[model samples]
Target: MNLARRALLEAGKLLVVLWLVSVLVFLALRLTPGDPAVLLLGPQAGRPDAAETLAQLRIEMGLDQPWIVQYGIWLGAMLTGDFGESARSGVSVTTLIVDALPPTLWLIALAVVISVPVSILAGTWAAYRGRGWFPNMVRFTSTMGVAIPAVWLGLVLIIVFAVNLSWFPSGGYVAPTEDPVGFLRHMVLPVATLSVFLSGILTRFVFAEATDVFRQDYMRTALAMGLPTRRRVFAYAARNAVLPMITIVGVQIGALIGGAVLVEAVFGLGGLGQLLLSSVLNRDYLVVQSAVLLTTVAVLLIGYVADIVYRLVDPRIAR
Candidate 1:
């Protein structure tokens, strides 16, 4: 009963936060410098006709309505899966998001797939052999990777793999229809760039957690029971250690999305990151709202799932 009540309370809190985010997103468009009308129109749009155009834009954009009324309309549209038309491209926001989602999913999915297993394995080994040179090397690499900004690291990879080595394309996105080989080639550097940094972050958390877990009383008991050392450490220790790592992973989902923007711009991948940049610059409210909302929802969803999984992994946690 307590656990169920707690879950319900958390869900309610999340909904409140979502509503607040909606209001903040709504207000951000009004608060930011420059008029969307002027941005869409021109610098010389101060004529009498320009005034008319601005009025029309205000109405079209729901800017003429009360703040609460406008928010209700936008929220209704969002609830109905209508994210509004893009001011820049005149396309459905959903179409843009759907088209852009695959690449980002591919990038994040591939990176996480590579990172989690590798990090877990390496972390386990390092915990088993903390004093070894290999563990020290892993520690140093993770430290350096965490310190270096992902954007800079992405540029370094581009220079080495694309510019200098001629192994991959440097700029521009290629659709699979255009050239599959060229498309994949363009993805390699950016995907790898995201993977490298994310891997570093995951590895650090895994190593730290695993090492601490190995010190527990139950872990010592498992070993004293004549179980194989690695088995005792991993099969038992991993469970306890993993709960804390779940939070780290949950938080990193947000960082990964944000990092994707920087990496995408640097690599010229036409993912949501690039779209987000264009939206912010042009004050495309719908696109901006969609981008930020999707990102927030994604991280929150990850956190929710992590909480559920953590409970399953250790039933005592729900107590």
Candidate 2:
């Protein structure tokens, strides 16, 4: 039950989970309906020679070969920093991802920053304030947040903030390079959209965790020692409560990336979410598969980081 062995075993298991997810995602995208070549090149419009173009596309994507061979080639190329070309744009999938990843990362980073601490604090407060009308109200709101769809929320924000108030851009990205102020203005809506959704879930977990910690023997001992409510609750209960909340948030990271597709499309923000949607629409298997794998890797990485930090906070976690 020592920490080191547990950590190693957990890490290995998480890696296996990630690998399985990647494989399935890759296969699923390829199995979807529609031909990427036709999606990209169109049906005998410019070519006026459907058969010849399809043969060329089959060769380019190795679709002319068996599934296993194609998978090997695709996976091999992927590992070597070669993402292959998009069927539609003839653009390298890796290049497109590089171009698109930053905005999505930035958006997620901002949302996380807002969600985590706020959730922890609010949850702690509610736990300490227990059974009060205010705490009950907060709990109800958190439940709603967990229930409501992020996409629906995004649309609501767009209508209220962008359309009704005559404030913020309803959709689209503004590159910081091209227009810094415009970029920020465009950022506010989507960031708020994501933050609201995340904060709700985090807050609920935090509240539950904090409440559990509040009942622990250590909290009673701290109070018996004449520690102030704030000090005892925060330094004792809050500290212990954070671990589970952290774990949940880490798990949610991957799912949020998937969730962002809807949010980004609703907001018209150009990020991996939007990119994933477009790739799906075009039936661009490589791009879609790559994006899903990338997102899954991110989730695993974050969860692993949380596990590492868990050991630091709760040294007994290893046992």
Candidate 3:
């Protein structure tokens, strides 16, 4: 019953937040300098009939409508699962997003799979090792990972693995349905770049939490109770330490989505991030608004899932 109520409350809150986000995205794009009509009409923008053409274009695009009315219309359409069409291409925003969503989801999933275990193991080892050369090395590498930009890391990976080694494709994507091997080859570098960044962030949190959990009185008692070394560490310390990581894992989805924008630009992948980037650059308001709103909702949904998982992991959260 409590879970059901909580879910209902969260759904309502999400709707309210999404409404506010749509309003902000709509207003921000409109308030930006340079008229979309002028850009769309380009060479003919300076013609004598330009003002009349612009007015007509605005009317066609519903830009001439008051902001509140425009928003109300958009909200109504969105509630019916319509996101309208791209200003430049006239392609449906929903269609564009549907086409591009797969790659970004794959990128994020692959990166998380590679990073999470490595981070947990490395963090656990460092916490257990206490004062050791290996821990120092891990810390140094994590520092570099956190400090390095994803784009720069991507370029370096491309140069080393794609250019020098000639092991993987430098840019461009192949759909897995067409060529699975080629898809994996193309994705390897981008996944590695994102994983390094995510691992760095997760490792630090895991290390801190594991270290603190290790020092708890229960851990000390376990150490003194003749428990097997692996059981004492993994079953007790590691488990408790990992609960904190669930929140970070959820938050990392948003970070990775943002990073995927630059990473996609670097790799030339036709992901949603790339679509969003191009839509924003071209001032495709319907596409931009839909993309940003969807991304925001995805991030929020991931966060809500994380909270639910945390509640499951730590019963105290339910109370």
List the global CA lDDT of all models: 0.81, 0.82, 0.90
Model 2 poorest 10 in a row by lDDT? 40-49
Candidate 1 weakest lDDT stretch, 10 residues? 237-246
lDDT by residue (tens digit), candidate 1, 1-319: 4667877887887788888887888788778998787787777577776888888988887778898897788889888888989887789998988888776776777677777777787777787687979999889887777788878988898889888999988877777678888878878888778877787888888889888888888777877789997677678766556667776777788888888888888988888888888889999888899878877777787887777667666678778
Better of 2 and 3 by TM-score: 3
Q: How many residue pairs clash in each candidate?
A: 0, 0, 0
* Candidate 2 ranges beyond 4 A from true positions: 45-49, 177-180
Residue pair clashes in candidate 3: none
Q: Candidate 1, which segments miss by more than 4 Å at Cα?
A: 43-49, 174-183, 222-230
User: Residue 209 error for model 1, in Å?
Assistant: 1.5
Can you write out model 2's per-residue Cα lDDT over 146-195, one digit (the tens) per residue? 78888888888889989999799898888888999998898898888788
Q: Which candidate is the best by TM-score?
A: 3
Candidate no. 2 TM-score:
0.93
